[model samples]
Target: MNLNFDFTEKRVIITAFFCMAFTIANLITVKVINIGFLGMETPAGVLIYPLVYILTNVIADVYGEKIAQRTIILGLCVDILFVFMTTLILFLPSPAYYTGDSSLAFVFTQTPRILVASYISYLIGNFVNARITAKVNEGKEYSSTKNLGILAFSELIDNFVFIGLAFVGVFAVTDILIMIVSHWILSLIWSAIAQPFTKMTVKWAEKGKPAEA
Candidate 1:
């Protein structure tokens, strides 16, 4: 039996690994930073969260749906493990001389509502993004426009689910609406801005391979 390993395959695996790591890290620190503008508030996670979708699209485009789905599931599992570990750490008594304990707790101690929201939003968003991208790519070459459209819808769903679930009772109705709209719009714009880089990544990943139909 003969086995083949290639640079492009290695790049795809590395990219997927980083994307999964980023997703978990971003979720963990999502509440660490909050910003307000135009009388609306949103978590700093917005800036980095779109990369997860972008990378997932690239994987689905260059590799396949199965790999992308597996990546998303892997990310979810990592996130769960991260949450569990952080919770355990939060429970342990801080060293008497460790001055950063408060800061660490402040950053890692997520409320139950926010944690649930993060899980729901991420699973639904990444799954939908990967599925839609795969379905669109079937027998068709990559289309940034179509991909953007799919991503926009998926992000909208993600923002709605996350904000609604996390802050429905904690914030006023209007504020929640603002958060959803702001997050959805910003995420769409971020993905659009990153489209060129995504194309480059996909092209790089697909190098030395037959072009898709």
Candidate 2:
């Protein structure tokens, strides 16, 4: 059997690894930070969430939809594993000398509702982003603007589902709506700002591609 250690394939694998890490981290610490001003509040994860979309777009653009979907699934599996491991640890007794169990639990213990919401929202958002990028750029040169537009819309749906499902009964309706809108807008803006970097990464991945010859 022949093996190919192609640079582009390695790039895709590395990007997918980061995507999985980011996805798990985003889910766990999403509720950790609360930024509020003028009567509006949102999770701190919004700052890094856009990167997942950007990476997904790059994968789809450089590789294909099949690879992008595989990455998403791998991420989802890792996220689930993270949740299980954390939950298991929370159930075990902490060391007698360790006084940070409370703090650890505060950060690691996720409610079932939030867990479900996160998984559903993440799968939907990532798959949609991949699909849109694949379809938009199919047999055509990649366009950052088009990718950003599709990502923005996908983020909107992602925010709506996650926020609505996670906080519907916990927060007031108005606050929930505000969070959805704010998160969606922030994610879109972040993606737009990161467009240059995204493009650069895609270009880097596509470099030295045998198929382009």
Highest TM-score: give the candidate number. 2
Residue range 137-194, candidate 1, lDDT tens digits: 9768788899888889988988899889988988899889987898888889999998
lDDT of 2 at 168: 95
In lDDT terms, which candidate is top? 2
- Please state every model's RMSD to the true fold in angstroms: 4.0, 3.6
Report how far off residue 64 is in candidate 2 (Å).
Answer: 0.6
As a TM-score, model 1 comes out at: 0.85
Per-residue alpha-carbon lDDT of candidate 2 for residues 73-181, written as tens digits (9 for 90 to 100)? 8777777777788778888887799888788788887778987887789889889988989899987877878988989988998899999999998999998998899
Measured on C-alpha atoms, candidate 2 has an lDDT of 0.79
Which ranges of candidate 2 are over 4 A from the true structure? 1-5, 27-37
List clashing residue pairs in candidate 2. none
